[model samples]
Target: MSENGAALLDEVEAFHRRFNVFPLEAAYVAVALWDAHAHLVDAFDSTPRIAFLSPEPGSGKSRALEVMETLVPNRMMAANATANAMFRAVSATETRPTILFDEVDAIFGPLAGGDEQLRAFINAGHRRGASTWRCVGDGSSQTPTEFPSFCAVAMAGLGSLPDTILTRSVIVRMRRRAPNEVIEPWRKRLNEPEGHALRDRLAKWAASVREQVDGAFPEMPEGVSDRPADVWEPLLAVADAAGGHWPARARVACVELVKAAKQSDKASIGIKLLTDLRLIFNGAERMPTAHILVSLNSLDDSPWADIGGKPLDARALAKRLGEYVTADNDPIKARNIKTGDGVVKGYYASDLHDAWTRYCPPLPESPLLPLPPLPRRSDPVDR
Candidate 1:
């Protein structure tokens, strides 16, 4: 590693120690940011953003953001801001703040009825240095104002975010606690001093290498689609500036994060059900209630059967699918479910289609540790 790179890594470690950050967690966070930087260099085809999520609440999303606020010299922004306020905050020349959006999903919601403006804002922010103008006040002839895009954005929420946002984010799916992995309650009174010391060191490091850290970037990686390439290019430059193991680490992080954001599973029964249903519709042209049930039941013999070791029945499938696609608290068609012989049962494909598009888009690349290929059995004679 170059002298500057080595020094930067040293400073990062020192900061981590000063703050009493758990080594593994700290390293992971560093790697995540480094990866974000790497993609900024070459994620031309990708969206340059990150989303942190946990299964349940109080899993440290806010705490993680607090630590990051200290490490990076960027300002925090609420994910719940109105479009105008958000734009103004990012555009302020006084501070080129890194935006942090906590509880983003809550702000957007499942249907995102009132979030169109926010959606547009986020889409624009995907373009580095992109700017837009919005009129202020309710005056008929009010003056308009222009705002620059976010420098960097980090969003945290429970479960998955909305599909549109998730499609463009480097997702960090926080794992629930493992049996052996326990975290003590963070007593701020006890740890504040140590965290503060680390914060000071990180600030110093930020000051010392601001120039190099701001400019250095690697060549874009292979297999990056057009959008990701654009979003991630500048981030990679940041990682390069930091140096040491960051350059390589940045690449790995880019690949992994992208895969998570746009991940797909051809093997999933959920995916198969949708695909199969689509095929059935294509071939049969159209079918009534009885045919739909028979066709769905027939899937058991095919590869698209069962989820989580249990066969997917129509009612359960409808309910699960409802979580993704349906907007109405009570679906219109679900009120009219009927069996193959015209018996009534609450399920419908219209709801399913809606769910499929929003909940499950295309998967990104397969995971690094892909499931092993099927094994071939040896012949008895050969044995």
Candidate 2:
């Protein structure tokens, strides 16, 4: 704990500042700690993905990873890579590789049709000892094989990542540099060596404190708990190890950046369905399955009415709602309603109560301002 400074971290931050224009100072600090953390990832239970995302192109997202490339161990720069190749690369050696995946949106975006295998790999890889079992060899002789997926990954891409991965990431929202804020044009040959020098220094510093950082519990800032806590613990440890301004700075950065991320987070379809169901249920204690479908399909803003040129069917409605579990850990299901004719499937408001409370914020009240008195009618006009 030096009184002077987090010298190495400051240097790393400066290095990033040279090329990329991050939207916030906290992002710069986070990225610097992330660079150092990558070298010591083995000491932690989970490694947070450093995601550089933007809504449009030329936002320097890839350049951010490019600068990061020189500061991490066994850096593997990949774009549009297959799941098999990536998993093989991760398990190639005794040491985990720092994968800097550029253009990752391709794997998750709509045009690519989604790669579930790769998404699963990225998600599982956040935690240590996460392995994917595959059938090796050929034909009848093939045997199940285990592949380790845990590694440090930095991703740069346009658009948002899936919520699962986004939760595991320390997101740095990159944007096009303003005209007045200038940065050095990055040329790998010349600038890379300096970054490598810093990288070497960071690795040495990390090695010295690997034992201390392992299983260390760094106190989190307020409102930081659960998954966010897990994601910041490693980076905070690295900052605490550096001492000086970092410990305080890191906490501030963690709180602010995390606050920003949560505020901007996109609600998942499961949460959305829970909200819509609450609105559709209205005041009734129960509603028939067919009644629910009609209400869901009638919403003009929702896609249910024209799903594949047909209204949402009962099966799809059930499937979508089934994605969530109740507070009692039961899958949400429509119970049977006994009518004059026979038993028919229907949903009970009580069944959805827990889900609505947990998933949706309090429903906003309508202002109901007095309609402006109908504009006084203008005495039926001059005609």
Candidate 3:
């Protein structure tokens, strides 16, 4: 590494010291931010995408994005942005700015009707790039202009984004600071020359490394999925170019964080709802709810079990169903299973296709059995 590179590492250490960020976490961020700055040198090329996420609010995601805004290039900060606006800014013909989004979880909430589409766009945008059109307004007619892909994306939000987006992003999992771990005032840097000097120096050093920041990602392990590869590839390239603790650090970060992402999507409860339960439903066609319990309880040993927490029990499973199919209009309902039956019982597959469309991904093959119609009772017949 060059003397300048060594100094850059030192400055990053100082930045962490000044800000009270954990040393290792700060290194990950510093390396990533530097990689991003370097990528900006050829902003026309692919840009890196990152997201700062947490399980709940007040985890310092926004503050971290703010610090990054001061350290990056061609920066744009949006607290709550529409999908169109986000795409336009990233792929603008005249100027493609690196994006920093705060409170982004609200914009992509599960209940928010627009979130799915926006998530899809973001997944594609951070990838090789998103292709969108801008209309040129003219007196006589309008012409459509195609904008290039996004540069880099940094977003802060509650919990993880869709797995697809997560796979493409360098995820920083922030936790709420303990009462004892207080950060210095980043806003007061105006009065602290050292803070300002450090930020400036880091930016300059990052700019110097711009030429070396290519988009070569290391091969992910077999267990690891390809979701975040596009976003993390550039940053890994930057780390390899730096060649020290950084390359190893980058890989470690990816492995650990990727595992976290996988775990985040795993269902916590034991009860199977939607298509997941539907599969078990098909496996034991027409069994009493009691027999179904034996099948689901056995799934603890299956790939679908043991999500974030331990495998959910039968009662927890019922609770999950209650949350989903609670409205009066819904046909499925969860009631206490008679202990005699040895399982919790409820109707199956009332809206299996709908749940699959909304929550689960598309299946690899056709369901094992065609969905059966709900059994209707026959009127009493002469004996």
Candidate 4:
């Protein structure tokens, strides 16, 4: 059974390689294991959502999910669906559905409307026995109903996900295929049937060892723990069961990819601001507000340049910095800087030191602490 598992996984990996180009080698392994995990997802206490996200279009994010659609059990690819419709779909089938959610940015983006229920639904769905409580029946006679939320989910989208979803997800930051890269074209008529055949074989292999997988707790590689541990456990278990080079390869991918995620983090705007200021400061004790504004607005790659459609001004920057406090328990605000022209408002290195040390300090070569994000734009920017 173990050897068979390895061979089948190899086939699945090959199938994916032929059609879609994943961002990294680990991404291929992760997605293959994710596909296999979907068949026996009931055995695990939680399901890690896999997100293929890229900054721009034509990055093969959708193609990756499309490949998985053929391989997972009861695969349902949805680009748009209401929370009510989704929870119902989850419970409607006898077999748990493997949701291949494409164009997820459309539903989860900042501009999206009436999606709080859906976000909550996806967040709650991470753990087993999780359910969404809803009212069924007419207004006065409404009965509380539980809709089961646990299911395997793979998402493809244009941008990063909110941290609520990120902590529970295996994020694959995809890149556009370089001109030198080329692969076989995928046609539904020919390729879908091949993928479906592989799915059937994977399902059989999974059924044979469901009990073993259910009881097994695969060991984590050094430095992988907490939510990262939870996310990779089942995939490691699948690798351990396969009894081949896969176990070693799986651990290698786990460590490198987890490390990659930490270095690539862009989740918090506040942290972004802190880190950017650190760069702009460059060992200076203080900078005039005018100089600071020029540096901030000059940053073409970061959001500070065009936050809310205008270059971040002194007042707005001050407001955001106010969210973090110094050791004295007061907002870190700018004080007078003695410039050659006149006295002008500016921030001191002494005042910002506390916020920098607490929020986005310089670090050693290890995993980064998960930084809390700042309040959203719903809070009045002017205030």
Q: For model 1, what is the error of residue 153's alpha carbon versus the real structure, in angstroms, after optimal superposition?
A: 1.6
Candidate 3, residues 1-383, lDDT tens digits: the string is 43365446556555555554532454454444443353343532445456777777877777777666665656688776676676667665456666778887787644444476567666666545467666767866989877665556778888656655665666667778887887677755562455445556655655666656544445653455544564455656665655667666666776666656544532222222454576776643233445555566566545334534455456655555555642334634454444564665554454344454555545668647888666556754445
Residue 214 miss distance in model 2 (angstroms): 1.8
Number of the candidate with higher TM-score, 1 or 3: 3
Q: Any idea how many clashes model 4 has?
A: 0
Q: Candidates' TM-scores?
A: 0.61, 0.81, 0.63, 0.82
What is the per-residue lDDT of model 2 for residues 77-134, given as tens digits with 9 covering 90 to 100?
9888888888888886576689999998887764568889999999999999999888
Per-residue alpha-carbon lDDT of model 1 for 1-383, expressed as tens digits? 22354455555445433433232333463434532342232233233666667767756666656545554444465756777777877787456566777887676544345477777777777665577787766769777867886456677777565555655665566655555555555556765455555445545544555565444445877776555655456556656766667667666666765655454332244555666566566544234544565676676555434444555556665664544445554442444544466656444555555654554555437746878656666533433
Candidate 3 TM-score versus the reference: 0.63
- lDDT tens string, model 4, 24-114? 8998998898999899888888888999999999999988988899999998877787789889989764777888889898987655553
True lDDT of residue 347, candidate 2: 85
- lDDT (Cα) of model 3: 0.57
Model 3: ten consecutive residues of lowest lDDT: 264-273
lDDT of each: 0.56, 0.86, 0.57, 0.86
Greater-lDDT candidate between 2 and 3: 2
lDDT of 1: 0.56
lDDT of 3 at 76: 81
Clashing pairs in 4: none
Ranking by lDDT: 2, 4, 3, 1
